[model samples]
Target: MAKEKIVLAYSGGLDTSVILKWLKETYDAEIIAFTADIGQKDELDGLEEKALATGASKIYIDDLRAEFAKDFINPMFQAAALYEGQYLLGTSIARPLIAKRMVEIARAEGATAIAHGATGKGNDQVRFELTAAALAPEISVIAPWRLEEFREQFPGRAEMIAYAEKHNIPVTASAAKPYSTDRNLLHISFESGMLEDPWFDPSATSNKDMFVLSVDPEDAPDQAEYIELEFAAGDCVAINGTQLSPLEVMETLNELGGKHGIGRVDMVENRFVGMKSRGVYETPGGTILFTAHRKMESLTMDRDVMHLRDSLISKYASLVYNGFWFAPERLAIQALVSESQKNVSGTVRLKLYKGNVIGAGVKSPVSLYNPDIATMEADPTKAYDQGDATGFIRLNALRLKVGSGVEQNAKK
Candidate 1:
């Protein structure tokens, strides 16, 4: 008799590696390990050999970088999605894509169940399972972190290490570093461990060494660098006169922004799982793109439309943060966001200096700023009538005047 087949979302990290071996033992099933290459740099190195050695019957490594940048990151950026006005939703945004691909692989492989390494306490579990429920429905999800038996067996990283040694599973992770990290093309995030205390700053040498995307702002170069970004329909098309693919553009900006120590954020954020967590993020390329995109929109977007889209920013951001990427409301909101970007084509010059992305200049072919109307110097043709101001001011101030009069009457 053949055993049930299970597809596992495997990272070469300690948690997933242990889960790979444990799942096989627990289920006595055929396991297929899946890894999504969404620009985790060299972290994908030797992942296949590791998974195979750890008892995975087969391994699937899909290069999803282009799809991630074009389909996921671009749309989120178009909506200017930021959770709680601080976090750029880096880790939050990546989960749906990872799960989506995992589901696809599971379906193709005829696997009856899918498993992931996301813990019970974090948002990724919800993300992975929610996506599976939405997409695959009939597929069972195997989340070992939520199992009391599994938790008792592993307890912590130390026990997991011991198990790995006993099983002869190859792993390089140590319990010395108390914090956890997640990285991809868009950003790198650090949390848990010493970061759990709100007052604990990770500027110490040991903690600083954990940063993969950027350096300390104080250690950045003394000189500032300026670059221009070109956008077409709210998507960045060119950088500094060079036309590159989506991922290439991101990589270029990451290099430039990291060098100047741009895009470092530290905050205590509300998780979808009903908890507050402190996270430190370095989003060098994403920060540059966000800054440049906003400047470009200001140049070309209409005032009323811009305000309407701005009203949706929080809601759109929340949808992304809460793992609603495939939800109907998010799709509706994305349509509007896409509509607003029809004319968001322009060039924005930005100055990167010591962690700051400052807009130097913005220009668009369809710019709303009319020099003739805006100039302090009077135009010979008199396009603006100065006499219109008296009526405009009185009409606008009428409600204020009426309220003040009513208050005075009440006092009397």
Candidate 2:
């Protein structure tokens, strides 16, 4: 009989590299490594050679950057999905797409099982398994971090490093700096190791070199820069008068935002697994896009419609953060969000200055703003009748007046 085949989500990192060899040894199966290229830049270099040398029978280096931006990042941004009102769900959003592709590769390769290197205590495990469950329930998911034998054999990074050395696996992790990172088109996140401490200051003098996307605000250029973003159906279509594809948009904004020291966030977030984890993230392009999109909405979207969608932001954000990107509820919310964006087409001018994305101006062909009614100096056109305020205020105040009268009567 042919040996059982397993597809592993390989990153060429310490954990995945070691896991690749371990899976081949422990299961005695043919290991097929799959690496998704979602804009990790130079990290993809020499990955194929390393995986092959590390004992992968076959390797798939798929480029999914455009798909990642258009399918995953764009829809998530349309809902303005910010987890806990802070996290941009950078790492959270990428997992489902990665897992979705992993399942596809498994099906094409006739693999019986898929494995990931996500730790047992982290959110990626949930994201990966839940996605697999949603997309391909029949395929077995081998999570080594959750297995007693695997965890016991390598309880710490040192053991994994030693094992990698012994097996001739190429890995970048070392004992001196073992912090974990997840990078993709939207952003790059750093956590674990030294970042585990909730109070650890990532901006301290000792950690000056930690940031990868944006410079420290204090180290940014003294002069501020301005740019304009044009949107159509809620997706950014152009930046500074130049049309760009979704992938180009991200690449350009990352460079611009990084130069201005924008989009650096350090927060302790509650993971889906019910644990609070400290993370530092650099989401330069996402920050710019989010700010510009909101400004565009203010100009075009209806007030009630915007407010209703705003109320669903938390729920939608939770759905994405909790690894339910393919769930029914998230799709329903996406429908509503997509409907809201039909009128969210516009242009927003912004000032980028030292970690701040400040709106300068916004306009849309379908803008609802009417200067005739909104102007305070005079309304010669009489668009908003001054006399209408009396009844409007009295009607709104009736409940307040009734409650006050009841309290007064009780006091008497």
lDDT by candidate, in order shown: 0.90, 0.92
Residue 282 error, candidate 2, Å: 0.6
For lDDT, the strongest prediction is 2
lDDT of 2 by residue, 145-217 (tens): 9999999999888899999888878877677774877788899999888888778889987787888888988
Clashing pairs in 2: none
lDDT of 1 at 309: 91
Please report, as a residue range, the 10-residue window in candidate 1 with the lowest summed lDDT. Answer: 201-210
> How do the predictions measure up, each by TM-score?
0.96, 0.97
Q: Measured by TM-score, how close is model 2 to the native structure?
A: 0.97
- Tens-place lDDT digits, model 1, residues 1-412: 8888999999888899999999999999999999988888888899999999999999999998888888999999999988899888888888899999988988998999999998888888988888888888999999999999999999988999999889888889787777888899899999888888989878776667777888888888988899999999999999999998888888899999999888899999888899988999999999999989999998899899989999999999988888888888999999999999999998999998998999899998889888888888896658888889999999999999999999999999
- RMSD in Å for all candidates: 1.5, 1.4
Error of 2 at 377 (Å): 3.0
Task: Give the candidate number with the greatest TM-score.
Answer: 2
| Each model's total of backbone clashes | 0, 0
